[model samples]
Target chain A: MSNEITTRMGDGERVLFSAEEIREDIRVGTAQAAERAGIPALSAEEQEKLFDIIADPSRIVSVQPGEEVIVSDDGCSMSFYGGQDGGGVGAPLSRMQAVLTYERACGADTTSLGHSDYSFKPVKPIINFEANDYYNTSMVTTAPFFYGAQPNLGLYFQPDGPCPNAAELMPMGKIDAARQAQEEAAGHLTRDLVFVGSRLADVGLEGLNLDTSGSAGDADFLAALNAVARLKEKVPDLPILMGASGEFIIGMHGEVEYDGQRLAGLYPQDQVKVIETAGADIAGVAINTTTTESLPWNLSRSVTFMKAASEASNIPVHANVGMGVCGIPMMEQPPIDSVTRVSKALVQIGKADGL
Target chain B: MNKEIFESAADAILRGDPEKAAEVARKGLGEGIDPLTLISDGFVPGINKVGDMFECGQLFLPELVKAANAMQRATDIVNAAIPEGEGQTRGRIIIGTVEGDVHDIGKTIVVSLMKANGFEVMDLGRDVSTDRFVEAAEQFNADIIGTSALLTTTMEGQRRLEYKLKETGLKKRFKTMVGGAPITQRWAKRIGADAFAENASEAVKQAKALLET
Candidate 1:
């Protein structure tokens, strides 16, 4: 029998790829992604090293048995948000408690505290110029518990709220109206982020995660960039981690631009440069997982894009490594076999600072 | 003369200009063009091109959504002007995000595509219970029921929907489709769904196939 290497697809199907084929995939995938993103591709030596790591015979691979790297999470409230019922029935305090326990058990470099609403939009009305103080007080109450925790504590929110609101105008056959609304919404989101960010910073919040920054497309990405700029100005010391929703920004408004570069169709490498310009401390890069493709294909593509992103960024590049991104399966609890391999590849081959 | 209007109609959709697309439909109707012809020969071709571009990664979600909106605008005007009993939908579909999953973008795109493909779709919105799927399907006389679950935690709701339909003896009455980021054909099979679509365009194709059989 032939000694072909086997791996799982994004859909968990077992597949085999020979050593030669896997290396070719890495080289071709990395070059194509680099060319498309307008960034430097991985060298031949780097591609061969990545292939070796992926083609390891073991079911799971890691940097070493006990070694670790910097790790941070987006949407940290999700575990408690889903809870036992999976209906977001759990309390926010329980989420904080879980984080503290996780830190105590298995240390993380950073942890985020957030509400289930996750987006700045819902909290905007609740914070309402301090008139209604419910949500802010909850944040204040939870901020102190993480003061001495091993992991750095940060607040998290997505800039996804405005895109849907703007899309509402499109169904009415108002294209320009939708574009204008997105612009206006970006301004409002910037203000809300600064307000919330400053308040949380006062309560010893260490960092802020702008999770899933471009879910609503170009307009959504602009809001995150704008927020990051304003937050740095307002809370100069607060580190911001901006994680993208996908590899490429969708052109929802299709006309909005940032720093003279069109936000639409920007890949991770190009995306991180703007994040650094906006003064974010970490650029969280994500590549979409194609469920139909083999794990080798997805992993190679993810690493290729991520390596470009890492090379382009002056700030720390934290690859988003779970749930349909960065070669991880789109499952709730991603299989460790794939997760370890992806993490090892990204750090060893992609040069990512964290996951 | 007619060819010029058809090309403009298609171009308006390609540019994702909803107002212009609707204007073209109105202009065509005023010029004595058949409503069906404006849709089948004009706008449908434009949307089909959008789908192909999207599949090949040339277009993104924003363009896809806008094109769908443009197609909807043109189709709405043409469909309303169709001779009384000649406006027949290809099939009826009811769709929603399964319980505890608030993700709606994927399902919304599927709804837009289904409508663009001449399927009568009633969107049930997000966080819909399994019972609501069966109830809505029966009420709308739907030929297919589509559910989306973006989270791995919420995928169980799709299986629950399948079980609820089987228990209510309505399983065979309507084809069931499951789709989302975490959903796969294997999961669909395990959950007893009739089909699983990887994306919105595939959802339309699956719905058509489900209706045929």
Candidate 2:
């Protein structure tokens, strides 16, 4: 008998990790290669902790019934600090497969599941094409189990900055792409909603420092809002879920001003006003950063932010957690702890009581 | 100092118009205003204000990038006026996104903030190889090397760079800082890095502290 590790990713991507390769990784290790690459290396404890959590499913915190769980297709965590591109045991499966697996674990109906895709580069035609492909494919795979589920498909992108070439394939035109994407998904997916989030590479809106020159931050915010509204107009009654970075939308508690001038207030009341004005059907608070890694410093406040958004929004508000990215368990904590923290936040802090 | 020229320079940057900022710089120079003073009084203040707003969620990336661009344009004009060695900069730093990680929004912010804080930064862009960091660091004689990895997988590039530096005995010569979403202080300490920053603002503070030490 031979011990083998085989993982399937994406539609057709398959990775087979031989025992020898695994041994080689252990011997040479990410630490040495990380050093050679001029990147940070996890300590021995951190390394052991990640493996332990991934190997044990029981460690993962279970989600309560009726709590909304949105699974993302971001491969950021599956890379596992260079175990080989989506090759390690911890590597993530393809987007659709990963979401289905996650949905099953949470006991969520396929129809009720929320699907997210990351447009790594955000090229206009390419991303739009991919979104269409993703939506149509989702309809096919999920149709069997789609009963009673309020299915969702979303794209993470930012408006392309001002481009002189109107015909160029840039992100600035994501709204137009959204309409096309919806059209593509039409007749394929039934009872589907749409979600749009900040596509900026680093942090979401909160991490975006305000451009003093002409209120660029406000422009982006309004642009996103307007795009969603337009998307709604095009889709006509199709639910639109606005992805709000907890840091910006909810993190802004109290009066926030730059240089003593009054600006957007951090109150949930104020936050809801913006969402309402955007005409979104729901607000999806992103807890991916907080539940996984505290990249933006104030990630701990994610739950509080979610609570605020939920209280303020007239529409349904849910929190999203990126399991693979955050659940890799870099600290002394178990990966399951990450899962537990997120589910707990969704239930306790997010006020996502069973519907 | 007409003071209005300074105000105009700041306003240009605030408007995120590089051409206008450069024009303001040129006008100031024509009027016999001190070029450095124009930067100190006008461009720097404007960009800093933008940073403040951005940190508080009043701004976004496109505007921030524009303002940074405007500031750079004005600064270039001001720098050309000063004799060699007259420009005041904290130190030269080489920064980039690690290999396999094309996400550079964080890295871009860090670069802009570092510049705002008086550091001369050489941005190598994203998905950079390890050897490139060393080569650039050596070629430029940078005082610090900063690597950003938004992905856990690509983060290995940071560690690999660390190992390569030690292997080449260049570890002691340069300071290393790591950051991104997945990076934590604990991970930084474990990796033997000099410092860890959670955001662009902290990256500046940490880089300055590391250089001072």
Measured by lDDT, the strongest candidate is 1
**Candidate 2, residues A209-285: lDDT per residue as tens digits?**
11010111222233344455554565444444444433442111112232232223233334444655656655555
Measured against the true two-chain complex, the DockQ scores of the candidates, in the order shown, are 0.23, 0.08
- In model 1 chain A, the worst 10-residue window by lDDT is A147-156
Model 1, residue A316: C-alpha shift (Å): 1.8
Question: In model 2, where do residues sit more than 4 Å from their true spots?
Answer: A1-106, A109-117, A120-227, A249-279, A287-300, A323-342, A353-355, B1-50, B60-89
TM-score of chain A of each: 0.82, 0.45
* Residue pairs clashing, model 1: none
Residue A131 lDDT (model 2): 47
Residue A199: error of model 2 in Å? 22
Clashes of each: 0, 40
Q: What TM-score does candidate 2 get on C-alpha atoms?
A: 0.56
Query: What stretches of model 1 exceed 4 Å from their correct place?
Result: A13-47, A64-69, A73-105, A116-188, B1-12, B17-45, B52-66, B69-89
Q: CA lDDT of B153 in candidate 1?
A: 80
> Best candidate, DockQ-wise?
1
